[model samples]
Target: MTDPSQPEDTDPDAEDGFYVLHLFVTGASLHSTRAIANLKQICESYIPGKYSLEVIDVYQQKALAEQEQLIALPLLIKRMPLPERRLVGDLSNTEKVLTGLGLSR
Candidate 1:
């Protein structure tokens, strides 16, 4: 049972809102590790229960990297929302990361 008039209707598929992210890393490098940590911290602190992070090791998953056309290591791609965005780096820049992910600073 649900109310069609309510704008806050609950969707099990997207209950907490959806965030599809792909983190492309070269391997178990410092940058890769930092990017993963920073992104995880940010997501958990700010957007907890509302984000999906997928870390892809380019060395192991070359096909996925090529599919995404990644030109740099440690690239973060926001795919769920419209007008997808991309950020390249270790992901230590909280302001930039938040902004790129359509979040307020």
Candidate 2:
């Protein structure tokens, strides 16, 4: 769990929306590595410092996987700013991922 007391880049009380991304991967498979790299690139390029990202390895914490209801590896969960969302797979489709995060028009 993130420390809510620590100051975040964005004002928690501000009206402007922010995003919390949780990525779940399994082991060190090629797909897992690719998803991490690709998602990071997209977030840095599009969302930049506006979002917070947390990567979790289901292989290390199987309980979290079940709790999150993750059906597959390389799952990305958008946890904040209302309308919680998720994307599953290797995250190769940049456009779809962006759309899912409501970052693209």
Q: Give each model's clash number.
A: 0, 0
Runs in model 1 with CA error above 4 Å? 1-16
Q: What global local distance difference test value does model 2 have?
A: 0.81
What is candidate 2's lDDT per residue for 1-105, written digit by digit as tens? 556863433234322567798999988999999999999999888877788999999989989889888877899998876567789998999999876776654
> Candidate 1, which ten residues in sequence have the lowest lDDT sum?
6-15
Error of 1 at 78 (Å): 0.4
TM-score of each: 0.82, 0.81
TM-score of 2: 0.81
Model 1 collision count: 0
Q: Positional deviation of 35 in candidate 1, in angstroms?
A: 0.2
Give the lDDT of residue 75 in candidate 2: 92
1-105 per-residue lDDT for model 1 (tens digits): 666643332233332457888899989899999999999999898789788899999999988888888888899998866447899999999999877776642
lDDT of 1: 0.81
